[model samples]
Target: MLQTRVIIILLIVLNIFHETTAYIFDVNYSYKYSTKKTVYSSVFLQQNKKDFRFLAGAPKTDNILICNTTVCKSFAFSSQNEAGFEMLGAAIAAGNTVGDPTYICAPHYIVLPSFRINGRCFALHENFKPIYSLDNRLQQVKAYNGSYEFYYAQGQVGFSAKYVEDNEFLLGAPGVLSWKGTVIKHTDLNIKNILQPEKVAEKNSYLGYAIEFGEYYFGGRKRRCAIGGAPRGDNLLGQVSLI
Candidate 1:
C-alpha cells in the first residue's frame, strides 16, 4: 500500500510538471501561501508579451482568471483590452460569469515611483493626469483614484508616497520635506526612493502610471513592484519614515 501511494504521488507530480512545461511560458506564483498555476504563451499587443494567466481559486472551482493573451477567458478574440481584463477580474471577485462588456470598469491604481523597494516613479495628477509641480527646489507629481493618491518627488530629496482613504492606516512623513497641500483625509501615506532611479525610474519620465498590471519588461525584464494594500484586509498598516 505504501509503495503504491508513493508511485501514485510521483506520477501525479510528473504529470503536473509535464502539463505545465508543455507551454512556452510556465510560472508558478505564490499568493497568500497558495500557489497559482499559470501555463500558456501568446502575445498581448497592448502588453507585447506571451500568453500568461493568474489563477485564483480552489482546484475544482478555480474560476478567477487573469490572462494577458488568448488563453483562459477570451473577453474578446485576440484582444487584451482593459474593459475585458476588468470584467474578468470583477467576475472572479464576485464569483460570477462575464457580464456586460460595457460595465463600468474599476481603475487599477498605481502610484509610480512606487514605494515598494526598487519600484518605478512617475508624476501623475489627482485626476490621473500627468502634471508637474515645482516648489523651491523640490519638484513633484501626483495621481489619484477612489482609494489613494500617489506622488513622486525630485530635488533636494527623491521618493514616492501614498495617501490612502482606508481608515486606520497612516504613513507619517519626516520633517525633511513639507506636506503643505499633499495630505488627504482618512488616508495612509508612505514614501520610498528608487533603489536605482537612473535605470528604471529615469527611463519612464511620464507623469502618469502604466495602464497595465504586469511585470515591467523595460530595463531587461524587471518585474514591477506590487501595488494595492495588504492582501488580506486584516493585516496591520504600518508606516515608513524617511528619517
Candidate 2:
C-alpha cells in the first residue's frame, strides 16, 4: 500500500510544472554484486514553512537513514573516506571551513526524498537537460535543434522569450496553444490571457483550475458541471464536468 501511494505521488508531481525555490543537497549511492546488478540511491533536502522533513526509501531495502552532519551512518563503508574528502574539498572551495556532511545512506534503498508545495515536487529523469540557463538572451537563439511540445491540463500558461526566436509561437493546430496573431513583443507576457481563439475553440484558451491530485468538487456537489465562456452561439465553448 505504501509503495503504491509513492508511485501515485510521483505521477502527480511529474504532470505539473514548477520553478526552483530552494537549495537541494543531493547524496548518491551505488551498489554492485556478482549475481545482482547495481542499485541506485539518492537523498533529498526539503523544507516546509519553517521546519524540515527527512524521509528515506529504497526499492530493494527499506532500512534507510537521512541525517545531518552530526550523525555518522554508513551503507557503503569502503567509499566513505574518498567521498568524505571530496565533499570537504568542495565545501572548502565554496569558502566554508567547518562543513559537516548530510547523507542519505542505505544498504539497499527504497524511495527517493521529495518535498511538495502547491501540489508540485521536484523530480527529473537522469538525462534531463536544462534548455535555458545562460543569462544572455542572444545566445539562446536556435538553441534547440529539434521540436518540443507543451501539454495543458489546467491553469494559466506563461511563455518565455528564451525558446522563441522572433518572439512568436503557433497556437492550437499542430500546437494546442499558438500565438493568436502578431509577434509577441514582450517575451515576459502571460500568453494565455492574450491568445486568440482556435478555430475549434469558442474563446481564447483559459484553464480554470490548479494542477493537483485530490477529490475535486464542482457546483458544491459531485457529478456537477460548469460551463465556461459567454453564452453566445459563437462564443460558448463546452462544459467542465466533475467525475
Best by TM-score: 1
lDDT of all predictions: 0.25, 0.24
Q: What are the clashing pairs of model 1?
A: 42-51, 113-120, 113-121, 123-207, 124-142, 124-143, 125-142, 164-187
* TM-score result, candidate 2: 0.17
RMSD (Cα, Å) for all candidates, in order, is 17.8, 23.1
Show model 1 residue runs off by greater than 4 Å.
Answer: 1-5, 8-11, 14-158, 166-243
Candidate 1: lDDT of 226?
Answer: 24
21-118 per-residue lDDT for model 2 (tens digits): 34254335422112133232333444445544332323233223333434423232222222121110000000011121222212111111311000
- Candidate 2 Cα deviation (angstroms), residue 99: 24
User: CA shift at 238, candidate 2, in angstroms?
Assistant: 13
For model 1, the local distance difference test gives: 0.25
The residue ranges of model 2 lying beyond 4 angstroms of the native Cα positions read 1-201, 216-243
